[model samples]
Target: MREVVRAASLLIVLCSAFISSALAAGRILPHAPQIAFVSAFNNSANLYLLDIRHGALRPLTQLPSLQRGPVWSNDGLRLVYESNAGNNNINLFMIDVRGGPSAERQLTYFSFDEVEALFMPNRGQTPEGFVFTTVRGPNGDIFMLDVPPVGENNRPEL
Candidate 1:
């Protein structure tokens, strides 16, 4: 009986800790603006955000390079995507969802192309980072990038 009681108490404590942590993470916006999905027309593609609630559309990226595969950050405040950058080399870049002077920044500058990037979903697993496929000739491998924390004005430690 004592063993069972102790087990039950431990379970209750663990469950409560999980619940509180989740609550502390705060709530995701019910209708945050969605990702920019470029549409193909006349062989042209550009980033655009669509607000389904109000049937509104806004252009987010206007660059000559081909942009594709946009993934939102865990906080939903930023977006990371791939751009060819007219150098025949695809690289990763980020943009703030909200318009501002510090809206855009190039995240990766590499001769080898990186694509299909995805932000780590679990905050605990990757405090600030993402993973993607790096293409190098006939060989390809998965790589992880640890992003710098916001508002720190410091470079990523590679």
Candidate 2:
């Protein structure tokens, strides 16, 4: 009877510690906006969108590879990221946030890795696209890519 009581007490203490640590890590507020982040599972990293207000999580990518550095366009309609798919060279890919994984389009096919992508603002008479750094040697090179129109999946001209 004493052993049973001790086991129950240990279980309760463990549960309490877990809950305390989770709370200390910070909770998503009920009114918080949605956010996109990457999480790794089973040796693969994928993108996910969290609806903070409702605490709903939706995966944005299901590829069996590493995807990271997601950045939103100025209008928030699309996201560009880097993925090490097809030969393990991290290249840029874009997807319409509302269209899910089926709308993902490859944006770069360079031999080296392209990362740190960000959308350039389209001010009055300015062209809009994303700029990224290509990792080759000790120092990487920055390149700008023009975004094609929606529904066009062809690779953008350099």
Candidate 3:
């Protein structure tokens, strides 16, 4: 039964190819999530992601301005931080880790200085927005802004 043997071998080869392609396409399994952080690099501060499993570091933000106080969302999908890029005051910004550096969005349009921002999780433990201290005139007050989660098409409203 040489024909029967050849047919079985061909079937096995096609199955193996399909399985290999599916795995390589990232459809069968996905990469583990990583942690994001901010650090000084090349004389300027920027954001970086740390792959804790393999100790690999990936640069997420490569701006010339100072990026600091990065706080990850409750779901670990986005980051909110303060940046002084092209502004006289430090303002809050949000960036998606999956969308790369161009995905950075300015959340605050005011001239006030915002600092120490952090994501506040809701009762269900999902990130609602961020709370930070802003300096208005001679006093600093804590402010909150509710924003849509990252990757959504909606723009954040103050």
RMSD of each: 14.2, 10.4, 14.7
Tens digits of per-residue lDDT, candidate 2, 1-158, equal 67445544544553465453231111122233555666666667787765544546677888898888788777666678889877789989887768744678888887788888978877844446778888897878888888877666666544
- Residues 27-136, model 3: lDDT tens digits: 11023435455555466777777554454557777899988777776656667888998887998888877775457887776777889887786667444867899888
Candidate 2 residue spans exceeding 4 A from truth: 1-32, 100-102, 124-127, 156-158
TM-score of every prediction relative to native: 0.70, 0.73, 0.68
Please report the candidate that would top lDDT against the real structure: 2
lDDT of 1 at 97: 71
Best by TM-score: 2
Overall local distance difference test of candidate 2: 0.69
Instruction: State the weakest 10-residue window (summed lDDT) of model 2.
Output: 21-30
Overall lDDT per candidate, in order of appearance: 0.66, 0.69, 0.67
Candidate 1: misplaced stretches above 4 Å?
Answer: 1-35, 41-43, 124-127, 151-158
Full candidate order by TM-score, most accurate first: 2, 1, 3
